[model samples]
Target: MQRSTPRLTRILACAAVPVMLVLAGCSSDSGSDAGKGSGSSSSASQDQQGGQKPATVAPAKYTKLPNPCKSVSTKTIEKLVPATKSKAGTSGKSSDITSRGSCSWNGLDDNGVKGSQYRWFDVSFLRYDSETSLGVSGQKRAENNYAKEISKAQATDGAKNVKTSPAKGVGEAGTAIRYELKKTGEDFSYATIVTRTDNVVITLTYNGTGYAGAKSPDSADLMESAVAAAKEAVASVGVANS
Candidate 1:
């Protein structure tokens, strides 16, 4: 009888195993339902947040820049630098001309009867492309760089009495940075104009000095020339792209 009683208890325990397993399954099902509800809410929240991403960016105004050497006109070149070594101007070395380009003209106008005048002009253009991933427009990029260029000119090495002012009618946005720099025992009047027209940023630097007792170039004259050249350079970008 004792042995039979022990076997009965063992049988009963085996029979209860299935009931315990059934109860566990039911608990799991309840948890799964709750999890599904929470997961759906989370997915909905994610979808709502995702709606704000992937901002639209406008197309760049100018995809390509003008020929650096040809950006300045022949007449302007003649007036700016009287005896330039190259009438076409010297093209600065640039690996990628599509986005950036520069040209420089240097000359020493030797007038034996009236001393000599040295003139230099450097002009550069930088084109910015809209970054869709970064959610930045090309115009905004150019605007940021325009400010940077002005700040950079104001911090030029050896510059003295640096002045900054608006360059009216030069471009959509423009700034003139003028300073005097002494080099090689000569005082050079420097005028730099930083301007932005849409996605393009134009920087024009014009400087001059006199030799053999001639008067140094006037700052006003240099600034005026810089503005004119900058306006032309800014226009060249549109013409090239158009």
Candidate 2:
């Protein structure tokens, strides 16, 4: 039984601002909390053993990702984000919704497994401004909304128990609230969520595992670290000012 955070709401009227207009703030962490594992870390060394160039860094065609987890690292993100294969060769993959002050990572399927790989770490970042009372109120509402989501997800069939904690000293933004959802009912999987909010930025993340295999997923801690890294990456980009 995980304790819930207070609800967050927004009050300000969302102004139409360019995504790059605001001076965005970002943060990161590369500590033991990242939970790096053998399979989830920099396997470049291993790639060479198997006779590969460690794969080229793919060209980053920067699309205006509304829900980009700017605070994490590409390396870390690459580990947590659901890969194309994670969907079992499905077409209509999960949908992402993003706005000036809000971002959401939705459409997660419990059965989105790939062979023995039935687990994935989904990640998302929601950026919003607490401009007006309405916006501010609405932004605050998210805290409660997320808390409730974790509560519900924990109580779900596969979720065994849930734990919510304050992600303190992990970034340079607002208070960060993290949720760890463990799997129950013979399913060995878990998920984590990290939310950061201040006057200028309100971001959230959904990182977990639903991959298949008789064993549970590895690298829960590393997944959490990646979320922190993503925050740092976004801060490097700065906010868009309009």
Candidate 3:
């Protein structure tokens, strides 16, 4: 009976060793899994803390605009608007000269019995800035405004025989619009050119009216003068920036 008891004790001890080893192995596996979960959680938290970046906008081409009254040459103005009241050109009211500006000239060429010829000319400029939130470039904004100006000229009230066509060698892009209107018992001819260069938009308008018994000015002549003046104005933008 004594011998049997000793053998039983040894067997029992041997069984306990395997059971303890199994428990230790399970504990080690649990610790390793916990460490792996902690690492994954930290990485995910870091990713959440960093927000998405904003989109980058392109740089503007031109930063400044030319002086409105001096954008066109004096000789050009004189030829376009004969007998001008102000050779220096009358500047339009502008809150921000850098962003927007304008100049105008008007005159009356009286011809005794032949009636009178009235001429008017005006030019305006608008500059745009690059925006990040909108993700739009200044040149793109100018392009949009250029289209709007052409549409406005074409939609002139009481206009007859309206025509619009492209003008070459004027700027990056240009459009010439011509129309006739009867106002105050006289026929008035209008020619407008809208062009864009870089980040600036240039709009030039040349108009003439015949008073008394004078014949209305020819549309072709007015358009030619407008295109010439527009080319000068477009060139001025580059000069000013340079």
Best model number under TM-score: 1
Query: Clash totals for all models, in order?
Result: 0, 61, 0
Each prediction's Cα lDDT score? 0.90, 0.40, 0.88
Clashing pairs in 1: none
Q: Return the candidate ranking by TM-score, descending.
A: 1, 3, 2
Clashes of 1: 0
When summed lDDT is taken over every stretch of 10 residues in candidate 3, the lowest stretch is 21-30
lDDT (10s digit) by residue, model 3, range 1-242:
98799767766665667777645543443787868888999988888887566777788888888888999999998898788999899999999888999999999989889998999999999999888788888888988888998999899999999998998888999999999988877889999999999889999999998888888899999999999999999998899889
Better of 1 and 3 by TM-score: 1
Estimate the TM-score for candidate 1. 0.83
The residue-by-residue lDDT of candidate 2 on 23-107, one tens digit each, is 2211113334344653455576666676543333322122133324333444554444444332222122334433332322223
For candidate 1, give the lDDT of residue 210.
Answer: 96
TM-score of each: 0.83, 0.40, 0.80
Candidate 1's C-alpha runs over 4 A off are: 1-35, 38-42, 45-50
Candidate 1 residue 52 C-alpha distance from true site, Å: 2.1
2-27 per-residue lDDT for model 1 (tens digits): 87997677666656677776455434
Candidate 2, after superposition: displacement of residue 214 in Å?
Answer: 4.7
Candidate 3: give the clashing pairs. Answer: none
